[model samples]
Target chain A: MKAVEFQGLEVQYGDMPALRDASGSFETAAMTAIVGPNGAGKSTLLKAALGLIPSTGRVAFFGKPLAEMRARVAYVPQRASVDWDFPVRVIDVVVQGLYRELGLLGRLRLSHRRRALDCLERVGMADYASRQIGALSGGQQQRVFLARALAQNADLYLLDEPFAGVDAATESAIIAVLKSLRDQGRSVVAVHHDLATVPAYFDRVLLLNRHVQAEGPVAETFTPEALARLYGGLLPQLS
Target chain B: MSALDFLAFSAPPMLIALLAALACALPGNFLLLRRQALLGDAISHVVLPGIVLGFLLTGGASTPAMMAGAALAALAAAALIELLQRSARLDPGVAMGATFTAMFALGVLALELSGAGAVHLDVEHALYGNLESLIWFDATDWSALITPATLATLPPELFRMAATLALLAALCWLFWRPLVILTFDEGFARSLGLPVRLLSAGIVAAATLAAVAAFAAVGSILTIAMLICPPAAARLCTHRLGPQVALSLVFAAASALIGYVLGGYGPLWLGLPASVSAAGMIATTSGLILATAALWHKR
Candidate 1:
């Protein structure tokens, strides 16, 4: 079954079209990478699929509507977006993942708290679970956020630029976690920037600008023509 | 100050400080996380016009009118800032600076123009509350409707403070997930089917209420100390929102006590009246908290 499907998706921020007429289906248990240059709508596409941004299109998870499938999806945003100095411990940040399943006003019961710690252990961050998030290295912080996603135990995970600023070991660890998730029948879509790691990491690629240039198996679809089209220089302005 | 005397002066301030801290810290968390620290300064300054207008229309310092006016005015200031930023495409600081300064200036102008009965708010009074005055303000008149079998009873000021704190606590708890998600990642929060706009507006409104209520006890200027300092200090000390908020509360309560002691005792030694100096004490104490936390963290 399709894990995520977007049909005729269109997004705009005011008059600027971030995504236009994008359509695709992503299989569950497959690793998909969205690649593009700055302002290329890669993040916008992921956000739109997650219902994070306003869009005119249809997105579904496992044939169910996006709204109904929220609890099944976990999101890891770009590291730059979060306040690194926020006064929260690693365990505290991880526990935020279980918030959707537990009613917001509900207490963080012992079981849920234990599960949060377990997720941290899965990411090799159990020792840092009580440390303030601000004190962790970039990769360690990313692992804590990953632990948050793991705590959710969601079927679909959407990660935005998790590799940025992360160390090599952390990157490898993240890849291993993603691979494990795929092996366990979960869908993972990440917006990636490193062209070199594409072949080694992702099974599928979606090249985009304001619209999808190409998509499919990594080798079969990531063509030179598509790269040129997606990253072409902007037209010169007339004086 | 003796423990009894400290209790007399410190209790009300502590209660007010606790509510004030939450009001500021709750939204301050987002403001800090969102990198909108100046917004607190903006609201506090801009609300002056609201207070002036409220006084003008209601014709006095009655609690309801002053608070309503301040809330409306502060909200208007927030809306105005948003409009300028979105429609005008100006930087956030530019938008906030223009709107808040203008509103604040207008407030000063209105106060000067009115030439009516001398309103209780002057420059120093605007900066801090008269804690000695508060002690004589007779906060005991309001009655509580308690169940006979119930094991809980509280004084009038305590009841009001508790009720106000409860309202904010409820919102924070109920929206904890979305608020956390939004604070950490607005884009992700929105994607997860959360109503980001509505949630933000609700938070802003709560912040406004917290600001207005806080201003009544500590005055406008000192209210900001409670809002900005605790959360910031907590940020230096912790990373989780729960502990951060708890730590901020602890710091705020301690500051209240310190302020009361300094205010009550320093007059005899330093030749400054306690009532006139309370706000300074609180602000200095809070600032010290932030500085000390920062220094300790660095080491």
Candidate 2:
């Protein structure tokens, strides 16, 4: 079954069209990479799908509207999208993920802290739980974000440039977590920045510019010609 | 001044200033985090025209009318700023700068041309408030404080401020999670099925209410100062949201108490007969706190 499907999703920013009728789907239990060149509206597609921006589209998850499935989906925005200097502890962020269970006005109790701590441990961020979020490195902060997403206990994870600005170790750690999530029958979709890792990291690839150029199993769809077409012929050497 | 003297002359305005400061500081935390500190400043500025308009419409300077005017003005300013940022594609800072200055100028012009300037509302009152005038004439001694008749005679702004602060605190509790998430990250809050737009509007609403409630009694100087400085100082003191909020209350209260005393008596003790502007003193004290925190605060 498809985890998420979008048809003819259109987004216009000011005068420029960011996403023009981009349509694609992330199959359940698979790892998909949304790869594109600069200004390709890669993030726009996710924002539109999440209803964060106004868009005209038929988007569905598990054959239901996104509003119905919000609790089941976890979204990890680009790290740069948030202010690092915000005064919140590492653990406080992870607890933000438990909002579904905590509900509005639910006092944060020990059980919530324990569960949040567990999610942080899963991302190797438990030790930094009490530290201020800004004190951590970019990778560490990214891990905290991932920990928060994990704490959501979501079945579908949508990440934007998860590996950007992170260390090699963080990259591997993130991939390992995503792979483990896929192994456990969950779906993972990310807006990937690094072209070189498409084949190795993602089982499926969606080549996007203003629209989806191609999308399918990475072996066939992630071909050099498709990469050239997606990046407008300035394709990086795909060894 | 003696304790009795403080109770009689200084208590009412000081308490009012403290309540207003706390109220403004509460939302200041969220606004500062959202980088909308100038929104508070903008809302406070437009209150002049809001009250003036209220007076014009009502043909009198009734408290409710002026308050309604301030609230409407604050909402209009917020909408205008949003429009400038969205439709006009101006930067948020530029939008706020353009909207507030124009509204404030219009307010001053209205006051000059209109008869609203004849009453308690004026340029000076709008800037520094009638804080010194909000004295406790009924409280001649300590026993007067407990007497029901004397308590009933207390300035209406004191009750208004207290009620405003209590309402703000209640709203904060009810909307805590959404407010926190919305301030930290709007997109993620929307993704969480939290009403991001409503919360965004709510922040402005809270700020507007604060500016209106405080502006009449303490003026724009203290309102704007409480809306930025205390929370900013709290931000430097701690990176935890709860601690930061609590610390802001401390800073706000200290600023109000110390500033009111200094403004009321500092000149008297310095061989001068006149007191300074309490609103100015309060705002200045908050600034010093922020600067000192910036220079010396650890952790």
Candidate 3:
């Protein structure tokens, strides 16, 4: 089943087109890496799919509109977009994932706290649950965010630049977590920048350069020719 | 006068000031967290014209009329800031400063034109309120406190402030989760179908209402101070939102009581002839508290 499908997705920032008529589909039970050069609208595509920004396009999840299935989707924005000095504990950030099901006035019961801690544990951040979010390291902060997403228990996860500025251990840990999600038949789509790890980390790859250059299984679509076209032949090593 | 007389004269205004401070401080934390601290200043200034307009239209500065005017004025100020920010591409600070100054000037001009300068809605009272004038004179004796006539004698501003506090408290209690989530992460809150716009509008309305209710006793400047300083001081002491809010309330109450005492009686001990402005003293006290907290936190 298709986890997310975008048809004629167009985004403009004041007159410049950020993403021009991009169309693609992400299949379920697999991990997809949205790879592209700088200013390639990789983040814009995820934001558009989640309806976080205004774009002229049609997006669907499980053959239905995103609005109807919003609750089943979890999103992790770029870490740099958040204020590190925000006064919240690591556990509080994770508990926010349960905010939807808990409703406005719903109290966090012991069961909910346990589930949040469990998610934190999944990301190897259980020991830092009581620490303020601002006190964590860069990779630890990213893991806390991933823990928050895990607490949501959404079937489809959209992450932006989760692997950026992380140590090798964290990079492998995140990939392992994404693989675990894919093993459970959940869909994971991430905006990835590194080209060397594309084939090894992701099952499906969508190469974008203001539009979809190619999208398919990594072996078939993520070819040296596609890299050359997307990168304007600048990536001689890949080519 | 006896101690009872002192208590009777001072308790009502002090309570009113405390309630007003609490009302403002509750939402102040959210404003500080959202980095919209100047919005409080803007709302307070713009609501002056609304109060004046309400007084002009009603022929009396009644509570309902003043509240409606203040709410409308605050909403207009907020809208104008947004308009100027978007259309003129002005910085948010510039837009707020421009919009509020213009509204406040219009309010002052309206007061001058309407010939309502002699009333309590004058410019002096709007900027620095006469808290000492809110004295309860109905009780001939302390026994009158139990009588129904005590209600008639009680300052109406006190009840208005108390009611506003209740409403603000209820709103904070009811929408605590969404407000925190939205302030921290707007995109995530929206993706969760949390009605981010409506929640923001509701918070703005509550802040306006609190500012309006506090206007008669504390004035706009003091209201802005109360809305910002206590929460800011509390934030320096705590990292969690819940603790920050609680500590802010405590700080607000302390500032009100201590400032009221210092403004009203401290001058007497120093051989002064009259008390200082209680609202000014409260604002100053909050500033001092914030400064102290900042120094301590830095240390």
Candidate 4:
């Protein structure tokens, strides 16, 4: 089943067009890496898909439009976007994942809260449950955020630069989690920063620079020629 | 005072004080978290016009008039700040400063023009409450008794209503973890499929309501101090929201009581005016707590 499909997707900020008419389909149970340089609309494309930004185009998840498919999707934004000094416990942050499944103003059942704690344990953070989130290290905080997504229990996961600043161990752990999700028939679209890991990490790759440069399995589409065009050739000319 | 007096006397005041503390502190947590700490400062200052408008419209300091006026004007100020931030590309600080100063100025001018100049407010009394003055005022005394207790004694200052409202508001917040997440981390909160905008609007409304209710009894200018100083002090002592909230309430109650007593009696023994002297004492105490916390945090 197609997990995500973007048709004539375009995104803009004020006046700048971040992503132009990009179209593609990502299959279920596959790790798809969205890669591009700064301003390549890598973040914009994921945000647009998650309905976080206004874009003129059709984006669907599981054959349903984004608006309708919101409940089935979970997102983990870039770590830098949040304030570390926020006064909340690690569990308080994770419990937020149950918000969608619970009604707009509905209260969480005790059983649902237990599920949240269970997800925290899955992320190896059961001990950090009561600790203030601000006290956590970068990777630990990322794992807490990952736990929040896990609590969402969504069919699809959209992560934006989850490994921007992290230790290698944490990186591998995150990759393992994504791999585990894929094994469970869940889909994940990660906006990856490290170019070297593209072939090893993701099953398929969608090269973006304001448009769909290419889309196919990483083994075939990640050719040296495609890499040059996305990074070397287009970057200097645009700037 | 007798032991019975201690038990009976403090209960009512403590209850009111606790409620007021929570009302100011809970939303204060959000404003502080948002780094819009000064937003309280701006709203409290500008709410003068709203209060005056309310008094003028109703021909008195009635509850509906006062709260409605404050809310409308405060909301207007917030909207204006948003507009300035969006259109002029002004930083939030600059926008808030501009919006508040203008609203406050308008409020002062309106009060003077309405022949209430003699009663026109100064900022010091507006931000902080004269808790001593509230000692004599009781809500139960004024109306037909709702309960048997009311038949025997006068109700305390209507401020109890504000406290009760604060408790109700805080209870709402306890269930609204999703709302707090959105405020502190909008991106991730949205990713979880939370209704980020709706939750935010609800919080803003709650914060506004709390501030306005507290403004009626505590006064406007001091409302910011009460709202901000306690949370500021609490942040030094705790890292989690629940504890921070608890600490803030304690600080708020202590400030009000100590500030009230010192202002009332401190100047009688010394050679100072009670009102000014009391405000100075509360302000100094709150300032000291905040500074000490800051220094401790640095250490």
* TM-score leader: 2
Task: Name the docking class for model 2.
Answer: high
For candidate 3, report its TM-score.
0.95
Residue pairs in clash, model 1:
A51-B191, A52-B190, A52-B191, A87-B238, A87-B239, A87-B240, A88-B239, A88-B240, A89-B240
State iRMS for model 2.
0.8
Q: Quantify all predictions' global Cα lDDT against the true fold.
A: 0.77, 0.90, 0.88, 0.76
Residue A205 lDDT in model 4? 95
* CAPRI rating of model 4: medium
Best candidate according to DockQ: 2
Query: If you assessed candidate 1 against the hidden native complex, which CAPRI class would it receive?
Result: medium
DockQ of each: 0.53, 0.85, 0.75, 0.50
True contacts kept of each: 0.84, 0.87, 0.71, 0.58
Q: Can you write out model 3's per-residue Cα lDDT over B158-250, one digit (the tens) per residue? A: 888999999899889998988988998887887787787778777777777888888767787789999999999999998899999999999
Error of 4 at B157 (Å): 5.1
| TM-score-better candidate, 2 vs 3 | 2
Candidate 1 vs candidate 3: the lDDT winner is 3
Model 1 C-alpha lDDT per residue in residues A1-239, reported as the tens digit of each score: 89898899999887888888998878788999998888889888888888765689988898999778888988898888777776667887888787777756677789998999999888889988789787999999999989989988999998989899999999999999999999999999999988778888999988888778787988887666667677785322212
Q: Say what the interface RMSD of candidate 1 is.
A: 2.3
Worst 10 residues of 1 chain A by lDDT: A230-239
Off by over 4 Å in 2: B1-5, B140-143
Tens digits of lDDT, candidate 3, A76-126: 989887887888999999999998789877878999999999999888889
Better of 2 and 4 by lDDT: 2
Q: Write the per-residue lDDT of candidate 1 for residues B1-299, one digit (tens) a residue.
A: 55444444556566555556556666676666666667777888888888888888888787677777888999998888777876778898899899889999988898899953276757666667554454412323322223332214322334455676789878887787788777776765665567877887777677677776777667766677877887788877865677777788788767766765676666767876444467667777888989999999899
